[model samples]
Target: MEVIAERRYQVRGMADLVLRIGKPEPFPDGRNFLCPYEIDGPLTQRRSHFGGVDAVQALLNAVGAATIDLELCEEVVQGLLSLHGQSGELGLPDPLALTRLRSAGTIG
Candidate 1:
């Protein structure tokens, strides 16, 4: 799969993690679909420690275990949703509302 975008994040000043977004591929049923993004680096190499759990829980546990900042994780998740056109399904406040809040120093 072709990588459409990639971002590298420094993990706790210890290691670098690269998150790669792949180009969407069309399914045999003629539906456009994006594959799960690829993650590489030291953190991923330890994922076996999180194996056997449900995917969502595994991810949450892994994030906690890595001690990544919560805000940074939120931004990454929101960016992925926005990139994949699923942002509207997030049930969060409108972007404009968030902007206003930020401008008002309500959120950082």
Candidate 2:
């Protein structure tokens, strides 16, 4: 697997970690497949609490994603929220609530 792209965003006081990961040569000789890793953070402890191996494992499990694809990060975030019982609506939900989901480690 490989990381083709990565992106992080700040959304109205939220902790979102959007990334793209995937295998190589899936799309073509010069292309590959990628998946998303949308996590939440105030990232509190960059290396201890939220930036360790466990965190990566949790993210992998959260989205059932093997690779990182920022394109699908939003969907992964929603799924994580839903798993945590925080995602209220399908396409739309409360923005603050989403942030809370990340902080709570429900997405992890």
Please list the C-alpha lDDT of all candidates, in the order they appear: 0.42, 0.36
Candidate 1 TM-score versus the reference: 0.39
Writing each residue's lDDT as its tens digit, candidate 2 over 1-108 gives 344544444433355543333322222332333233333334321211111134344343323332223223444444432322344222323335656898999885
Q: What is the TM-score of each candidate against the true structure?
A: 0.39, 0.24
Model 1 residue runs over 4 Å out of place are 45-108
Tens digits of per-residue lDDT for model 1, 10-87: 544245556554444444455333233555645353212222134444343333333332223543444432223443
Best by lDDT: 1
Clashes of 2: 12
